[model samples]
Target: MTAFDGIGGAYAENLPVIMISGSPNTNDAGAFHLLHHTLGTHDFKYQIEMARKVTCAAVAIDRASDAPRLIDHAIRSALLASKPAYIEIPTNLAAAPCAPPGPISAVLAPERSDPDSLAAAIDVAVSFLGKKLKPMLLAGSKLRAAKAEKAFLELAEATGYAVAVMPGSKSFFPEQHPQYIGVYWGDVSTKAANNLVDWSDGLLCAGTVFTDYSTVGWTADPKGARIFTADMDHISVTGHDFSRVLLADFLSGLAQKIKYNDATMVEYSRFRPNPTLQPAAEPEAALRRGEVARQVQSTLTPNSTLFVETGDSWFNGVQMDLPDGARFEIEMQWGHIGWSVPSCFGYAVGAPNRKTIVMVGDGSFQVTVQEVSQMVRLHLPILIILMNNHGYTIEVEIHDGAYNNIKNWDYAALIETFNAGEGHGKGYRANNGRELADAIAKAAANTRGPTLIECTLDRDDCSKELMSWGHWVGAANARPAAAI
Candidate 1:
């Protein structure tokens, strides 16, 4: 049940995943025997039915004759749509005789754009790109879903336009590239990057979704500005919508026609004459969010995967620079509080060679803290940076309530119980910058299993972006009903 929402999130983030689970016995569908896993009922179809709301395909393998077709169809649908698919196997079907399985080679062939639509989208985009002040390019999360991040990068390089990635699309383009600007998340965007992008006469947004979350509570103005958007299956230009013009095809086509221009980058350099880095808090000073971030930033190595939990962690983690070959994972689309704890474990399990770093708030940490024991049992060397603030700070920023508070936990000490003298998991408390640095060093040294460093934080401490975002989002949510 918990996995359902996260799987649904993949669809909104424009990613693909396959979820498989077993349903109740189908033979006694109407016999209400109050099965243990059936939510106090005998309905065997609720699992598939609920999945249907979020997955591109949801199917059951009831008969051996239907297994191969149903499974193949579910996979193909998921891949083609870049969304999740669910497969349910009944308990009775587990031991049923079935034919030998064959290889599953469902191919997602490159889809071509409609010729006329492609030509028009390219022409419309070049009108913006070919300007004396070349338009800026804003890459969105869908670039990965469309499998067009490479194409998007090629387009940026060929056109010489400055590129800024959406917060959700972190690390899609090499952040170290000369043509790259910082994130373009409206008011939360880096000042120089925000100015450069906003001042442009025209902008081309590729594979972007402009929900309230992405727009920072409808305060972002990309769509309101002079811009054209290219999505997975269509391109919308000024007063024109071109359907069936796939994002990848449009990028390839536009790259062939657009002229090179570096005006945007030139302006960016002048606006951000000297990149600023505030000095870290004195080593013995109490740990603030930014100071903890600074310490974690120092620990990022090449090819490490970062898992940022929802809440203020989103704001902090997104600001960190990911080394080349590093990846960023966040469940921002769903905004599920506890998504990171287990997701980090899963990522570490799948890519054992890469270090997995997770930053989570105290409230969210408690939601799925049990996953830490599994990581210890598997002896996975993952780093968990926990902010022990005693309550849900993000919620308080948005809408304060009694429910926002949570009992404080001794998070660092709790990890020792998981370690149980046999496991290699290590836990430490960091009350200051020096303690944080020391804990990280020890985590790096402990190569056998996971490590938890619970950094103490003031109850009200949070990123400025979160406060600003929460203010706007709260206003939007509280807006009174419009007169019909």
Candidate 2:
């Protein structure tokens, strides 16, 4: 089912989402006729069986009386695991008479780490830090799910170590912070980030994840430094593994136990220069990816939330210089291409106080372009930077073929077609730097509805990093049979 990818995304990203579905009633057993959407088979449990693979918890509510308890269990499991849950209610059971729901009293938070494990993890981490002359911190994306970002920042401040956030964890720590270095992605690391991380004798890689894409085709090297990992549900330092030690608790405890160590920062300052992202571009020159990044960075405000589609947009977004309060949303794990349109719309609905700026490529935009109409109908103030590249550039970089090309659309005019001139949503096409600046200014002033700016670019125009990354990924995928 289409919902399967979303559920998988939630699981991989560690979001607590609950999905409810309707099924044939218990009395309709073997009738396949009872439900039109049933897989048209006698196996009634097939749906839940498939869902169980991607969800943290899956439950079937066979009776009206059991709904409350079953639902509570599902919710609690999903919350504790920071993953998705599925609840299926039969048709007859759903229609059955039940007592009216009561207002929820305060819900309880998940349990803290095991006391023994927590104490041991902190002691080991403290001991490890005491032995090292030069140590550094590496932040990862999993900190969001662990609710450990504040603690991670506290640890970074309490111990004056230079920090390099893994590529996937960009913006986890305030990028503008004094101690923050850059995004570390092995060979593609920013400025001196990889050097600093590799040179350290001790490393604390908190909440980090390493997949082929994140590691750039598995070329990332931690070097010979001893790694102390405060993973989601456990802490692993050297050879010791402390189970049931939550990341938040371990970080909080480590912050309390450690004092400032200026060795790493002293060395970092001796390096060439501070990291710079997306250097300034000429406003009069033809538009390029760097120019797009530069313009996007200029548009970010403290109240803005940037959404990056899963394509070259991801690499472009990495160049943004986020303000202290700016939020960056990217579905990097289970990267379904068209996820941004719907997701950006949903985020606008949830956080109306914040402005949404989404960068999506033409190939990906076509997949879920219909969601923009919902924005117009709701009068949501959002800015969509559509890159009309005429094809799947990310795919072309990986392995070019006829299927990589897409039919080009007049993307800027789509807003008028969606509204038929009824709604206030506006659209503009940007061919160069001047057009982009004008479009952005107009978008900033438009609050009645969403504004879309389509920036036309060549199909082959993409980040050089993307091309290099794709080559490695292609090689990894095309290894000889004997290598395995």
lDDT per residue as tens, model 2, 1-484:
7788888888998888899988777877855454577777677889999999999999998878887777878888888888999999987787777665444432345667999989988998999988999989999889999888999999999999999987778878998898988888766676568888878999999998877777777777563438887899998866799899988888988899997897988998888365465565567777787788789889998998999998899888876678998989888777789889989998999999998999999999999999999999999989999988898888888789999888988888999988777898999998888889999999999999999999988777898878887888777777789854
Best by lDDT: 2
Question: Which residue runs of candidate 1 sit more than 4 Å off their true CA positions?
Answer: 30-34, 39-42, 98-103, 107-116
CA displacement after TM-score superposition, residue 26 of candidate 2 (Å): 2.8
Query: Where does candidate 2 clash, by residue pair?
Result: none
Model 1 C-alpha lDDT per residue in residues 366-396, reported as the tens digit of each score: 8888999999999999999999888998899
Structural similarity to truth (TM-score) of each candidate: 0.94, 0.95
lDDT score, candidate 1, position 77: 88
lDDT of 2 at 22: 84
